[model samples]
Target: MGEVTGEVIVITSGKGGVGKTTTTANIGTGLAKLGKRVVLVDTDIGLRNLDVVLGLENRIVYNVVDVVEGTCKLKQALIKDKRAEGLCLLPAAQTRDKSAVTPEQMAEVAKELKAEFDYVIMDSPAGIEQGFKNAIAGADRGIIVTTPEMSAVRDADRIIGLLEANEMQDLKLVVNRIRSDMVERGDMMSAEDVVEVLGINLIGVVPDDEKIVIATNNGEPLAGDESLAGQAYINICHRILGEDVPYLDLRKKKGFLAKLFGKN
Candidate 1:
């Protein structure tokens, strides 16, 4: 048989507070739930939180630093997910700076990981700094996460440009925390607007929901839930697997005349 290879995707954002880590945790868990051996790597280095989001913080004995420093094997540093069978996490070191590991080292580690797992999701640090470079060191693809706001959309555009500069050609967008009510009122940017601005393939559109925070507070991803945002993540997982999944109805009804027709 031919040599097996898997996807190495870096999930990132240009600015902070765009729910990048949360999206990574959910998507990683969702992919594993679909029976794809998935590993979520926290490349946030000094500000590691993917472990906490996945509820694997208390179980970490070795980290990415250890793996890169040759103190431990990659298998030794991987902390498997509690809920998902095949999901695991290689958490970042909270004390080490971004300079602790070189891009070459990260790329080597990712190469080994992609050989064993079906997907390697890197939770990139916010900003276009060294941490960002390290996060995308070996990524074959990139997913930019942003909100339905002007600033977020702007930052996402910048991140997309950086990803292209890095030669990561397979780039996509995931618009999160979209408030349909506000979009309908013309107060929030719709998914179509963000896509038009960024000019990238739209992969996922996650709605704003309280369940996401609740799931994070409980140290779990909102993957198995039935909430709108949770279901959105599930659909995203399917799309990642090359499935032709259509987006759900996120728009609300206007007046009867507008509803019966197609426009207001």
Candidate 2:
């Protein structure tokens, strides 16, 4: 593939606690690290958490709802990241619900942002309700995040089906929190197994790392680090830029340590 121009992509996971916000924050930061102008928008109204993931929760004065409601200009709602100079965030409203905005409004906002940035990343809320519809309305593609567990995979499958039904042809998968040792010991699903079940193009496979928790607590993104999960996020960002990267080998070893520890 050639160098990708500006593209709008929604990072969505049908179920909650599947690392959707973290995927958004890290991928945005990773693209910014490559010197690309990226804008991350939070579409999880009322239960907004993207701001916290990016460590800009306190900086959000205006939000996406504000822009859609004409309460503030689009530029006024953007919070620039301190670390990634080329990255910005459009936070979600803490007081609003899914009813506060419509799909057309989201498409308009995305269309507006696409004029200036090289990438527009939307962090979608869980479920297949109006919120999901609103989040995916204006996107050129999607990055579906899921864990190795059956529940997350099931939800991801449903999300993929919905995207396909909407004719969103560029949907990709990101298997987050992969337990490498577990896969080796036949405990968890391998990346190949996930691809087999989803039957979709794979973009990334991020390992479950303690550093992610640490980074979250520090309000920093793991994309800046070279941890197992961090590298995966960075690679996915490159792939979004149309770069081809071989999938990382997460199931390389299985020994006593693997048996001593529990599988994720």
Candidate 3:
């Protein structure tokens, strides 16, 4: 529940539109639900959505840029989540780009947050650039989020290579937006395939659920819902804590004879 120095974990993806921000939000919230002091930093400056997803956009008088510029202390910029205790968000500045902050500044912020929180979870902007570098600079652990599509998997491979070059230990993978029906029909790559292709330990796999879109639009994380996606994220938190959680069977169930054959 308390730590003198916390672990910094970056949730990143090489391509956009792969649910990186949403994963970060839910993972941070899920950890907070377990009574861990968690802080989610939005490193996607200019195109900030973490605040919106957490429903704290109007509460943001200051941002990460302000913290980096010394205009406001880190504590002053954090927006506490009313939905979960021990959870806070350091939002990105909508007016600034990734260049607004440097890798060293990000490390400094992480160090400061570590003293107060048990986990410093960063939501890195999609791609391998200054923003991604800044996001990973302070992290002792990294989680790469990717879908099972070919493009996503290819980008994830490149990101993993980059993470290795950065000497980031404890790197893991989270396959997001998996389609059960497609997998059952052999129309899409399975989670196991993604793990094999990426060559990293699979931390979690989120099923494709329509509720996630509604949750994001309503400014609530899908993890609070009882849907498959929600439970997947909760399981992700447990895995982050080093728990040996079982993966959910999200494949579609067919006729008795079809079920006899089992999923593809």
Give per-model TM-scores: 0.93, 0.92, 0.94
Candidate 2 lDDT by residue in tens digits, 167-203: 9999899999988878878999987899999999899
lDDT of 3: 0.91
Candidate lDDT scores, in order, read 0.90, 0.91, 0.91
**Window of ten residues with lowest summed lDDT in model 1:** 248-257
| Model 1, residue 205: C-alpha shift (Å) | 0.4
Across residues 86-197, which tens digit of lDDT does each residue of candidate 1 receive?
Answer: 9999999999899999888888889999999999999999888888988899999988999988888899899888888888899889999988999988998899999998
Question: For model 2, what is the error of residue 128's alpha carbon versus the real structure, in angstroms, after optimal superposition?
Answer: 0.4
Which residue pairs overlap in candidate 3's backbone? none
TM-score of 2: 0.92
Q: Residues 1-264, candidate 3: write the lDDT tens digits.
A: 245688999999999999999999899888998889999999999999999888778898999999999999889999999988999999999998999999999999998999899999999999899999999999999999999999999999999999999998799999998998899789999999999888899999999888888888988886645888889999999999999999998864478987788683
Between the candidate structures 1 and 3, which one is better when assessed by lDDT? Answer: 3
True lDDT of residue 248, candidate 3: 94
Task: Give the range of the ten consecutive residues with the poorest summed lDDT in model 3.
Answer: 251-260
Candidate 3 regions with alpha-carbon error over 4 angstroms: 1-3, 252-264
lDDT winner between candidates 1 and 2: 2
